[model samples]
Target: MKKKITLTGKILLGLLLGFLFGIALKQLPSGYIKDTVLLNGVLKILGSGFTSAIKMMVVPLVFVSLICGTASMGDIKKLGRIGGKTMLFYLGTTAIAVITALFLGSILKPGAGLDMSNMVSGEVTIGESKSLVDIILNIIPSNPIQSLANGEMLQVIFFALLTGIALNLVGKNAEPIKVIFESANELCMKMVNIIMLFAPYGVFGLVSSTFATVGSDAIIVLLKYILIVLLGMIIHVTVVYGGLFKLFTKQSIKPFLNKFTRVAAVTFSTASSNASVPVSLEIMEELGVGKTTRSFTIPMGATINMDGTAIMQGVAVLFIAQIYGVDLGINDMITIILTATLASIGTAGVPGVGMIMLSMVLTSVGLPLEGIGLIMGVERIIDMFRTTVNVMGDNIATLIVSNSENDLNLDLYNSKPLKKVA
Candidate 1:
């Protein structure tokens, strides 16, 4: 019989087992195990290794896939159209996400009961904001090689777009370059497959460490804040995405949600949309997105589509405001929504990006930077859920856009799954 298990299933099992073990350790007095190598060394290594492996693939996969995507466009005007539409959709959804989050958070008042005196102040300082000119200038890297080396995603995207456009301009001469990039893209995906085989172990370590460190008590302490964030995420995924699908494609949400279940599970378990890109792209294709739409939209969305991050930023701002006993004016609320939406695009999609963007949101509203500390302990755990929602939002946007552009193939979408990566 063929192997029945999938990478996603294996990762889910890992997460489940790891959480069980962590809870057991927490409940039972496993002082010896805690003091011994399991807690300090083995667990940390596994978690770090998984993250490092994912990060290792990010720069190469993005650069190659982006080059492939852009070059495959064949027409620069098509690239411009797709780019414009994708950005508009992403930015619009981000704005909607933050607004919904702010609205829900205000109604719920998640921070009202929290005691501010006991909460620890965050030590990390917010960075200085750049002017629009500076932000634009920074997009063109002085050294493209250095940008990739440093994993500067925006700069890398900029460079890749330019290269792809230049290649398109070269006409037949670009064939060899396109071939090389396509091959590299295939190789990088293979690398992702190889890395994913170790996913069970990696997830076990990461989730175990995360739960052990955060403990259930922290969840109790921050229950209100957590619930509000989660509620906002659910609203965005179910309501906003659902509405978009109905409005654009006139399709039932059932099929989309069914297809999304698997991708969302992987995204939640791994907590990195960049890491989840291969799976998301695969699922999007399976859900009827054409090669062109999937290639262009999914990768770009992985880079900048951040509904989850935006919602978190908004809720976090409200949580902080409530904790500080500050009443935010209407202007303040609008400012938060705009700031979070823009920051979602501007911020890199690496780990801790939500926190960094939260700082930006707080800074825009004159909220205390120190307020971040209150939530840092739980940020890692929260990030997993937020990112799952982020990936889901991206896929939904891609589907809607594909349908709008008449690029989706409903027959292919309803077909059986693709052959699993060997």
Candidate 2:
């Protein structure tokens, strides 16, 4: 009898193979084969195409799923409670994540002996920081159609929640609209299923192109910084997230991690939290998270719950400070924690968001923003690991919320083989 490899297995294999292939491609002299054919031609098309396909599903998936989730809750108060819990978990975990990163960065001293003289600094662009009032108002969506078109996730989430609530309140009269949303939700999920079928090839392309393009000299110079950021991510996952899971759900962390392996692979490759939203929801469903909970929590978490980005920002702040010989006091660290936590909510779920959030934190505490230019060398690589952490945080939040509301199906969660997609 022949054994069948699951999608997770195939995706992991693709990731490994892609990394190795990228390393190999790096060895080739700069030429048409390395720069044009393999790097730009095959890898670029497959990876970009795959990522575009995944992104194509995000707006619709988030919109339809949230409506289905909110409307299905059947109680406005319960929806509010779930919303409160989700926000608390996201923001609280993010604060803890930054603190953990700062602690490790301080103790490990990843930047103590860093020599910044020879390193090349890239031009760093920082966006204008929004006030709290502005951010709050922006969530209301002045024009929902524009929000959806522009992919303004927070605004879209706001509109979807309102629509779902109205649909639920209208009772029988809303049944037709509700049914339309349900069908649209199913169709969006089906699109996810189809796109996922090409995940392995996509993973290969994205990983290979990244490694091929990156300069190894920079990676070697920043080895300690790289290791520290990775270490912070690992610790955040094991201690903060894992500890919280055991504390709240009273279940071992193994099952959830096991189920999330596929999502982690995609997130690490794509390096975009929003791009992984549809897949995260699918895996959460397989883990027996109620449609209502996963639908609302997964998309919202992807947009706001940025524990991984917080970790990077925390460590980067310390690294940059040490590089610039700036001594940060307790007050600075506290400000970073608060600023990063808030920035996580405001930041979009896209690639390179960590750097933007880091800039804000640095500005808050009088750290030189030029430090961002120094760390740009290894940012892309670190982004992959941090993205994996980000989506995992999203899934865990979904599971905890679902379990608390009696929306978790233990039998499905513990089943030997995951339920198959139809």
Highest-scoring model, TM-score: 2
Q: Tens digits of per-residue lDDT for model 2 on 1-422?
A: 55678888989999999999999998999998788888889999989999999888889899999999999989889999999999999999999999999999899887888788877466677676766577788899888999999989999999999999999998889999999999999999888998999999999999998898888999998898888888888888998888888888898777777778888898999999999898898888888899889888998998999998998889889988888899899999999999999988887788887887888889899987778888887888999989989989998888888889999998888777745554
Which candidate leads in lDDT?
A: 2
Instruction: Mark the regions of model 2 whose C-alpha exceeds 4 Å error after superposition.
Output: 418-422
lDDT of 1 by residue, 1-422 (tens): 57788677787898899898777666655566684677778987887798788779988888887788788778888888888888998999999999999999889998998887776644756566544456677788999999999988889889988887888889897898899998998898888878878878988888887777775766788888888899998888878888887888887777767777667655665678887777677677677787667777877888788999898888889998999999999999989887777777766766677877787788888998889888887888789889988888788888887877788887776666567655
Displacement of residue 382 (Cα, Å) in model 2 is 0.8
lDDT of 2 at 213: 80
Off by over 4 Å in 1: 1-3, 28-32, 121-133, 417-422
TM-scores for every predicted model: 0.93, 0.96
lDDT scores in order: 0.81, 0.88
